[model samples]
Target chain A: MKHNFGAGPCILPKEVFQEASQAVIEFNNTGLSILEISHRSKEFEQVVIEAEALVRELLHVPENYSVLFLQGGASQQFAMVPMNLLPEGGKAAYLDTGVWASKAAKEASKLGNVEIVASSSDKNYTYIPQGFSVPSDAAYFHFTSNNTIYGTEIFEKPAVGIPTVVDMSSDILSRVINVADYDLIYAGAQKNMGPAGVTLVIVKNELFGKSGRTVPTIFDYQAHAKAGSMYNTPPVYSIYVSMLNLRWLKAKGGVEVIEQENIIKARTLYDEIDRNPFFKGTANVEDRSRMNITFVMDTPEQEAAFLNLAKERGLVGIKGHRSVGGFRASVYNALTISSINALVDTMREFEEKTK
Target chain B: MKHNFGAGPCILPKEVFQEASQAVIEFNNTGLSILEISHRSKEFEQVVIEAEALVRELLHVPENYSVLFLQGGASQQFAMVPMNLLPEGGKAAYLDTGVWASKAAKEASKLGNVEIVASSSDKNYTYIPQGFSVPSDAAYFHFTSNNTIYGTEIFEKPAVGIPTVVDMSSDILSRVINVADYDLIYAGAQKNMGPAGVTLVIVKNELFGKSGRTVPTIFDYQAHAKAGSMYNTPPVYSIYVSMLNLRWLKAKGGVEVIEQENIIKARTLYDEIDRNPFFKGTANVEDRSRMNITFVMDTPEQEAAFLNLAKERGLVGIKGHRSVGGFRASVYNALTISSINALVDTMREFEEKTK
Candidate 1:
């Protein structure tokens, strides 16, 4: 079994994959393939409801929030956030900590005014910006919880007094979260959830319809919430797979339990990097991500040699994002402790052989 | 096996279902589930490209058109059509044939002027409105070629001088279409293609950028077409299942052979409805859809009693749409001749019991 550490479409539980494969064959023994069953059927509706219920149970989502599994990814939300919240002639504040955060601001720029309150671009986004006060007059303060490309995570939700929104695409369910901390939380399902297709959106109901323009119904959260995300045919397979993955997460003692395991995985790799003179960690230790551990070797040749060694040991997708290249080990909830250990052994053996 | 008559996601070949199920467990034997592989990976990129190619080959699409597999269902396309095609202050004509067509018009009304050139709502949408003229000054003529609820279909494209737009959600691929007749064609994948979640949009590359507003990248046709529908993580499972189904379609001799089989299946059911004293088809005989065959019994009791019998005989999803309270047997391309024969036998047996 190869160790997969690709960023986004990272990893999932084997049992979930097995169950999903069975569903694709015959869901509830209905004799109809899951791919060909009606989305309006009772069998499929249960999947949607169960997925939403799991999200609520795992995260302790408050009653005021409406959880939606909508089409389009985080990129679509980049445009939808401004279209739904930034009223005509209104301004919004955003934090720029990575490529995705900057992309979100760019999409919002076409809708209304977006002011960058703080940015870590000067340091190549190696660390999360801190201690910047959000403008009280802005429509909402938006930020990304984790920088996937640069391996940085904001440990605490910014205490922005205004309505706060978060694009938690990469680190949503990796740890415990107080749903009330933000007015809206959005994430693409490719990371910890299931697959790429449906996006998860948790929005406080009161923060809608304030945008001055007539929002398209498909893009309107109120429309999706009212219809329970069935305004049309949803991506049924994506939702079903996600339900399986979440059910597995809950079975493994929920996010609280998973977070501890994640901390161990992160520490194991970071400690190895710190102990070995040949390796160096990329992000500031204080702002390092528990989900993605980014690191570099002393030289390009050494980095290439280490990658070849990792490959020989069945490690795959460990390559970092091309823009910030070296290596990234994405230890999502589904990535096992044993896989990380194997990767660690690969690195140690390479060091011993070279020395 | 039960006969499925639900409107979409309806029936698909068992072979396609099996292949899709296997893909979920282990795609291309890469030890990674199809749901876990990166979309940018060469393995998945081929799936996207091949699906587009099959769409073009089966539909005989013109060289000038671009095919896209996009997130969101046909309802999203309802709004996207206008957002992408209708210019500010520009009027477009429409044929409001049924609930879907009216909904499309409603969405278009939010974007620009949508003139309902003709409608059959006055008659409960029992027949297709014909001989209506498309305005030369209008942006384009929009119409739903098949009405799943009303069970009516336009046998021939309206001879319009302006550009044409078609929402072929429920009936595409059941029959052949002249690619040159329309400026754009959009369909939800649940019906004739694959599953819900991914919509198929085929557009003439030129009729873009005329919509006076800056369309959000997610809704912008030009943006999606340019990016090959990977502007973000697409519904990967949906697209992969679609490819498997399309490959099956091609192996069965493409649309020509499939359409012939579809006709035989429709004929078997429609013949029984017309010949039996206890039942009658509701659609105009000339305009009745070979895709969705709408019918009624001699009385409500007979309809209810027959539905019970059909259920007992393992028939699934034969209930009529609520608005039209008879029964609709949606026999899309994937439904088999033997399945329709079984439905016909059930109806005949019920008649014999009542008589």
Candidate 2:
């Protein structure tokens, strides 16, 4: 079996895939493919309801918060967050962790004034910037909780007095979060959630329409919340598959259970990286992501040789981002311990061959 | 045999469904579900490229145009169209035919000045308004090619002096059209194209970046076209299935062949509607949509009775919009003429029993 270690749009449970695949042929015995059913139909309405309920139950999202399943990835959210939160001429504060974080800030700057609260760019984003003070006068504070490219994660939410927005695209659902902490949280549902078409948003209801700007109805969070995320024909099949994946998560004892397993999985692989002479971890020791584990070798030839060996042993998608030129084994929620063991074994084999 | 006539996310070919279902489990023998594959992978890149190529081939799109597979459906396009085409303080003309048409105008009004060139709302949008003069000074003239709810269609493009844009969400690919006639042609894939998560946009290359307003990068057509619709993670499975559906259309002799079948299918059903004494067509005869045929009975009791009979005959989603309050049979590309016959037969059966 192939061990998939791809970052975002990553692996999902086998059972979830099977059930989703079956629905594509005939959904809930409705005599219609899930792809063909009307989003407004009672059957599909149930799918959306259950998907929302699953998000609520698993995350313990507060009742005051609205959970939306929207189209356009987190990239779209970059613009939308600023449009709905930052009023005309208002300033927003942002922390630069990596590419995604800086991109978020740049989009916000196009709409209004933005102050870079802190940045880890000095070290090539090898760690999350700490002790940054968000301006109290700013409309809202925005940051990326997990930097997929840099393989770093913020375990603790920054307590900024103003509203806080976080892009949790790569690490959401792999670990539990107190949903009440952040005023708004959005993630493109490709990694720990489900697939790519849909983005998940959990926002405090009170935050809706607070900005004086005349946001386009489609981009307005209040419109979506009032309409129950059926603002228009949502990413139907994407939402359905996400519901299936969520069901699988619930069956496996929710995010808390998954988080424990994730810790062990990351530790097992990182231990090997530290112990192996030919390999080295890329990110800071404390900030190293439990989701995407980035690493490298002393020589380019050694890295190339290990990648070839890993491929021969059925490892897939371990190649790192071009910015960080080695390997990134993304161990998401659906990645089994067996897969991690397979990678560790491959690394050991490489070391023995090198010696 | 269930004959689905849901407006959208509507029916697709059984073969396309089978292949799409298989790919969800194991895409292209890569040991990864299409749902799980990275959008950046060569495998999925090929899926996007092939989908774009198929659109170009089937639509006869010129080299001067770009075919984009995007998320957020036509609703997102409602905003993007204006954002990309209408410059700051520029006036745009719109034809108000139905709910979607009016909604498009409403969204454009948020961005800039929008003038209603013509409106059929006076008669509950039963006919496409004709012989209306578009404002020559307007940046663009927008209209709905087919009104799904009102059962009306504008078969010929109005030669408005300015740029022309059409929302072909319900009828795109059911017939052949000259792509160069309109500056932009967009369709939510659910109806005739593919599924709900993705939307198809065929836009002229030169039209990009004309809007002087700082359109958000995500909403900008030029950014999407430059990146080949890969500026962000796309609706992967939706694009894949659409490619499969397009392949089916090509093998069945392309849009020209489908158009003939669609004409005959519509004619056969309209013939029954006119011939039958119990049922009466709703839309103006000359403007009745080939995609959705709306009709009603004299009494509410008669309509309810006919609906029950229709349901028992294995017909689904034939119920009309709540506003229309009768029946609407949406016969999209994948809907076989045999299914149309089933609907016609059901209508005939109702007449025989009532008589």
User: What lDDT score is found at residue A328 in candidate 1?
Assistant: 91
User: Relative to the unseen true structure, what is the C-alpha lDDT of residue B25 in candidate 1, on a scale of 0 to 100?
Assistant: 78
Q: What class would a CAPRI assessor give candidate 1's docking?
A: medium
Candidate 2, residue B176: how far the Cα is off, in Å: 1.1
Where model 2 places Cα greater than 4 Å from the true spot, the runs are: none
Instruction: Give the Cα error of residue A81 in candidate 2, in Å.
Output: 0.3
Q: Give the per-residue lDDT digits (tens) of candidate 1, residues A55-97.
A: 9999999999999999889998998899899998889999999
- Candidate 1: give the clashing pairs: none
After superposing all C-alphas onto the true structure, candidate 2 shows an RMSD in angstroms of 0.8
lDDT of 2 by residue, B261-346 (tens): 99999999999999999988999999999999999999999989998998999999999998898999999988898999999988
How do all models score by TM-score? 0.98, 0.99
* Model 2 Cα lDDT, one tens digit per residue, A1-355: 8899999788999999999999999999898899889999999999999999999999999999999999999999999998998999999999999998999999889999999999999999999888889999999999998889889999999888888999999998999899988999999999999988999999999988877777778899999988888999988988999999999999999999999999999999999999999899999999999999999999999988999999999999999999888999999999999999999999999999889
Q: Among these predicted structures, which one has the highest DockQ?
A: 2
